[model samples]
Target chain A: MYKYNDFDEAFVRERVAQFRGQVERRIDGSLTEDEFKPLRLMNGLYLQLHAYMLRVAVPYGTLNSKQMDMLAHLAETYDKGYGHFTTRQNIQYNWPELRDVPDMLSDLADVEMHAIQTSGNTIRNVTADHFAGAAADEVADPRPVAELLRQWSTDHPEFQFLPRKFKLAVTGAAADRAVIKAHDIGIRILERDGVRGYEILVGGGLGRTPMIGKVLHDFLPEADLLPFIEATVSVWNRLGRRDNKYKARIKITVHEHGIEEIRRLVDERFAEIRPTFNGVDQEVLREIEAQFAAPEFRTDGVDDYDIAYADNPLFRSWADTNLSEHRADGYAIVSISIKKHGATPGDATADQMRVMADLARKYGHDELRISHEQNVILPHVHKSDLPALYLALRAADLATANIGLASDIIACPGMDYCALATARSIPVAQEIATRFDELKIEHDIGALKIKISGCINACGHHHVGHIGILGLDRAGVENYQITLGGDHTETAAVGERAGPGFSADDIVPAIERLVLGYMDLRDSADETFIETYRRLGAVPFKDILYPKEAANAA
Target chain B: MARAFTPKVITSNLLLSGDAVWFTANDTWSGDIAEAEFLTDEAHAELRLLEANAQTGVMVGAYLADAKLGDAGPVPTHFREDFRTRGPSNYAHGKQVETNV
Candidate 1:
């Protein structure tokens, strides 16, 4: 992780002080709610349904044990004894008092963390692939460039208030784990002829309007990354729709003005803005890159891991679901499941944070990453350490053998906590997971992703789920609309809606019907739900979801 | 022509406590929805929402929630508003844990 320099330290301290003053003014009747609301939102504070939610940035979702401990400390001190890691790779504290937020910001500053640009119509926290450096398929470690962009975008004067909230994601690997296609600006680290650069994609996002990003540049030189990104967002900030809140995302702008025009505008703006950077950002990038240097790995390991996998079925099941191939030999990337059978997705208690922190320090080389799927990743763990790490995780109730499985669903806090939600999402997700768990067929069902969103904001990324469940309020009744074949990978496609909405009571049964139907429709067990959907299309799933309509169609 | 108002209650999240609060007839915020003042008139609901919104030091995000008059007072008409009174269904926290005297 990039340690904060004196400038970084001073800037955050001053910002925290300024916010403290603002909070003080609001408390003393000197400032009205109307006056203080935007200021609060600018600092990642939201007046949610029941409380003021403070979303703290976990830059590119990378954190050391010290930083993780600080998050645990904040959870214990200022708010509840828990933090909710969001899909954007940030953690949100749902119950912090207004008077204590300034202090909380100062506490975060002490750990080189702040909530700036995590909310409002600004470029939100820049996220990257969780397994950036450690994945076997990575072309380069992306965090350094991500860190550089973080520095460049933090309170960039031109983009403080854009047409809407903008998001950026970077992926270093060939596999699109970060859902880069669904971001405002998605950068992929690429290499050609011994030189590294980025494949820039723009106008990708999901909300009311979902779009797979258009390739803006086949290969943008490494030096041009910062200014080019600035040029792109600047163009968007200027011309994006401000008339309607729903159509404000850059996706709509790109849809309206075509990517060729956007490319022309960005090129023109890039020419103007390129000079101001003057290689200063690249100079900072070199400094940031050194901090992200890959950890030293030993060549000899795996005796204990082999024995554990052979001897312990429970350990074997978890390892099968939760472990991924690491770039380092004899090392494995461990993903700790937050979606335990029927628990709330993305929530980790203070004790759980401490446990993950302790594991990261002991075996993970003091490195941890929060995945966009709302799970924690220990990027580098020796194969020998797997048995011990798995044991610790199991004891903490974090080891659920359901990573990328049907039960490991992503859900947003819907009407439960959010003020904007039309219907409840968490309960729906819980019901689905519980139903799947009771059936004990999640592993048999194979790699299926079920993402649930409260409404159209797509916070839970329901648009990209294999089975996307969208909760809507239909004339005072909670209704769920299912979508089939939504893929979040490199071959990203928005899921097609199955049929008319199902009532809250009927949703789980509807999903069960669809999955059971998929079992018969699939050509082979090797065919995944998405692959089958690709082969057979949405008809099979739709037939199961709405039997009466399918009967009429037949 | 203006549309007629449905029954509504002025609601907000308390500043200090961060708990859901309803505007009462006595010009005070109450945690219980049963103590809320149901307004059937459009102008009166708007006036009450404004009054609640003006309590900057006490409340945040003051708005109107649909409610209906019960034998006691007002009750949430929509499930979403009903959920506000009983915290989240995930776990028994916030209003779910609290007991009234």
Candidate 2:
């Protein structure tokens, strides 16, 4: 993790002081509710149905043991001993009194953390691949750049207020684990010739409207990244839709004005601003890069990782699902699966947090990551440490061996806690996972990312899942709309809606029908759900999910 | 009519660190609210004050009001409507105060 510099420390301290003063003024009759509301929301505070909610940023979803301990302490001391981890790699506490919030922030600041830009129509937390520094296949660690952007965007003078909230994501690996295509600005680290740089993708986002980002720059030189990104956001900040709140994201702006025009504007702006950042931001980036240099590794380990691979069936299954190929020899990057059967997606209790903190200290060389897919990663576990790590994880219920299986769902809080939700998402996710587990057929079904969002904000990234389920309310009854063929990979696509919405009672069965339909149509078991969906389109799945009514036809 | 008015009620939480005092519609935070202080028209305020007394350490903030001030009972619905029409208007220290924008 990137440690805060002097500037960072001063900024957060000043922000906390400002908020404390604001709270005092609101209480003392100087500031009205409307004025204080936006101010409070900007600091990740919300006035929910029953009480006030405070969301704390877990930057890029990465947390160390000290940070996790602080979070656990806050939950135990202030809240109901539970905190909800969001899809955007943040944790939210549902209840915190107004007076206690300032104190809570002070506690968080002790650990180099604050809730700034976690809300409001500003650049929110800059997310990146959870496995950024640790991924064996990474061309470079994306976090240093993500960290640099975080500092630049955090309360930047001009972009303090905008049409709506903006999000940025970066990934260094070939696999798009960060779902870069579904962000306002998605930067993919690439190597051209012998030099490393970025392939900039812009205007991709999911909310009321969903878009697959367009490639803005084929190869953005490493030196020009910050200024170029600043140029793009400056352009979007000015021209993004302000008339309708629903159409305020960059996606709508790109759709309305076309990507070519956006590119032209960004280029023009980049030219103007490029000179100001000459060598300064690059120096800062160089400093950040030093902090993230790869850990030392021993080469005299495994000759062939097949001995243990052949002996254990469970390890074999786990190895297949939980491991990603590393560019390093005698080492593997492990994604410790947290999507246990019937558990809340992305949630880790205080005990679980402590266990993960311990595991990171032991096998992971004091490094831990939170995947955007709602799983944790211990990136640099040696091939020899696999069995021990697996056993420890299994004891904590962290090992379910279903990394991309049907039960490994990514779900938002939905009606359970969110005041903005239309229907329940957590229960639906639980039911689906439970249903699939009971059938004992998740393995048979193969890799399927079933993402569920409470509403159209797409916080759960329902728009870019292999199978997306969106929960909506029709009158008082809950309804679910299904979308298929979407992917959050190197080649991303916005999901196509399957059919008319299904009633809450009918949703699970409809999903089963769609999955079974895929099985029937697939060329072989080797073909994944997403692959088959892309090959055959929505016709087969849609027909199965929304079969013609026999009674009406009769 | 002095006959009776619906009680205005607001939903709020007790702060973790607040003065141990009772808030009154008369904009007073006093420590002298007792069960017997409930008179016919002053019943709602008196009851709320007593309730506030129980949560001594908790910070007292956010109150519902219908813009009506009398000894009449507080109507929760009217206060809820007022809260919706205008956000959490009053802040509490030792007393309720209408904040300025």
TM-score of each: 0.98, 0.84
What does candidate 1 score in Cα RMSD to the true structure?
A: 1.4
Candidate 1 — which residues are off by over 4 angstroms? B99-101
* Candidate 2: pairs in clash: B6-B75, B7-B73, B7-B74, B7-B75, B8-B74, B8-B75, B9-B76, B15-B59
Q: How many angstroms is residue A465 displaced in model 1 relative to the true structure, after the best TM-score fit?
A: 0.8
Instruction: Give each model's whole-structure lDDT.
Output: 0.90, 0.77
The C-alpha local distance difference test score for the whole of candidate 2 amounts to: 0.77
TM-score of chain A of each: 0.99, 0.95
Candidate 1 chain A: 10-residue stretch with minimal lDDT: A537-546
Question: What lDDT tens digits, residue by residue, belong to model 2 across residues B21-95?
Answer: 224544444332220122234566556646644442333344433333335432223322222223222112122
User: Which is the leading candidate under DockQ?
Assistant: 1
Q: Candidate 1: which docking quality band?
A: medium
Clashes of each: 0, 8
